[model samples]
Target: MAETFAPVQPDNRMAAMSIVAATCFIALSTLFAKMLTTDALGPALSPFQVSHGRFVFALLFFVVGVAVIRPRLTRPHWGLHLARTGCGWGGVTLMFAAVAFIPMADATALSFTSPVFTLIFAVVLLGETVGWVRWAAVAVALTGAAVLLRPTPESFQPAALLALGAAVAMGTENIWIKKLTRREGRLQILLVNNLVGVVIASAALLAVGWQSPTSAQWGALAGVGLSMATAQSFYINGMARADASFVAPFIYGTLVFAALYDAVIFGAVPDWVSWLGAAIIVAGALLLAWREGRKRPTRLHPVAGVVK
Candidate 1:
């Protein structure tokens, strides 16, 4: 008798695990950012500077890493690279700007809207079909977003609009990245994105007159970039190994970390209403991920002739 093995499927568990690690790093990055930028330096730098510095450092780091790992670059996918770069840079700029204004957790929750946008983009730009179930999932996510924003008499923060814009750009970028992945390597994707971000952000800062940073501030900036870079690597590695449904909700758990960091570091905390909104957002996102899992058949495809 032949031995039988269980069927394997490409679940997003690894991606979900990546989210958890990424969230932690991101929370730390936010903490360092709030401290280094405001207290250490009397003058606050614009979002352009922070974003530019982060990308420049991140790109340099990635380049060095790639040189060591020496991952083979596939044929250039210029169209996909351009699309991803354009949308990603736009989103990054907007999100960073929002961070300069709002509490980190609130901005993060707003950024969660990116997936909702991605779902719509997949259907419209990628020509992918989403059944009514997924659309309903999307609707729930939107409802959660509304709860967070709450345009009624009290709960609105205009700064959140920047985060909402970031979501749109991020959503568009996700579609472009999905397209690029067909022909490009993951590091290559990061390379193009960082390059674009550095170029665009640096150019924007030139118009406003860039601020000189203290050595400590520079160190914090570098720290932010490095933490984010490591987070990305961890996410990629983790998601490759775990089931997505098992991992995604924990990624949202980053908000808890963010809130705690904000309170301890800046004495900031979201009101009860905001907390409720965050819960709704998480619930909706969970539904979307679950629905996504149901729609796709669970079977892992071998990549580059290697079983993951």
Candidate 2:
């Protein structure tokens, strides 16, 4: 979706910081999700309801943003927005579901395989090229993911599969996002995506029989929505300034935060396999980031200040 070299602006610091900030919020979102989907808080809420709450509350935040900033709404890119929202809603719902059954670290690490899928989508859908180095990087990351999957029946966990599916869905969402960034303003992009997402999430919640959340669970759901909205903003802003692959490695920061929350709040210590798998995944992803950085230029376009 992007040029082989991203059309990066000179505000590299802002882009990098935005990605880092996104990672933090992303971890917070999943932390809340783990609480809501499990007894860590109260009666577990369904992933559909959790995801629905995510979209609704996030849309509410943007509504306030719109009322104040009053950004001149861009013409709708309906088809793209719909496709992106479908994948985003599904990916997050699957992830919220997975965190209910697996350790937050395990789910987060497996999701790290997303960039490999993002690279493949770029190559196939956009007709971009991927050299052997990138292919090798893909292999390394997949191996790490497989370590987490442990598909054999004895050690197998179906919940891990949900996280893997989320990775694919999220990776597809990444391509759509990168395409959107090159053409749209950041705030409007988020506003429209959430607008589309709330519609989808609401329909799914209805199908699943939505239930009222406990007061504590309501707070958790709000955390999912607000944190995800904030994370989405930073992620979108970062993508506007960097390639999707370039943004991928920095997201590994999320695993650290997720692991910390799990340990501190849930007291669910990670086993050796989780640590090992995550290390391998990060190694491969960071290598891809290093190569992508060396290849991308300092300034290929004037992408400074706000995307608008």
Task: Tally clashes: model 2.
Answer: 0
Predicted model with the maximum lDDT: 2
Q: Highest TM-score: which candidate?
A: 2
Tell me the tens digit of each residue's lDDT in model 2 across 1-308: 22222233634446667877898899899888878988877788887888889889999999899889976555667788888888877787787777778876577567667877887888777565677766766677667655644434422386788888999998999889878876666787899999888888788888989777888998888899999999999998887776565555555566656666777777978788867766776786667666765763555545443333
The C-alpha stretches of model 1 lying farther than 4 A from their native spots are 1-9, 40-42, 92-112, 129-165, 234-256, 269-271, 288-297, 300-308
Give the range of the ten consecutive residues with the poorest summed lDDT in model 1. 1-10
**Per-prediction TM-score, please?**
0.73, 0.78
| Cα RMSD to the true fold for all candidates | 6.7, 5.3
Q: How far is 71's C-alpha from truth in model 1 (Å)?
A: 1.4
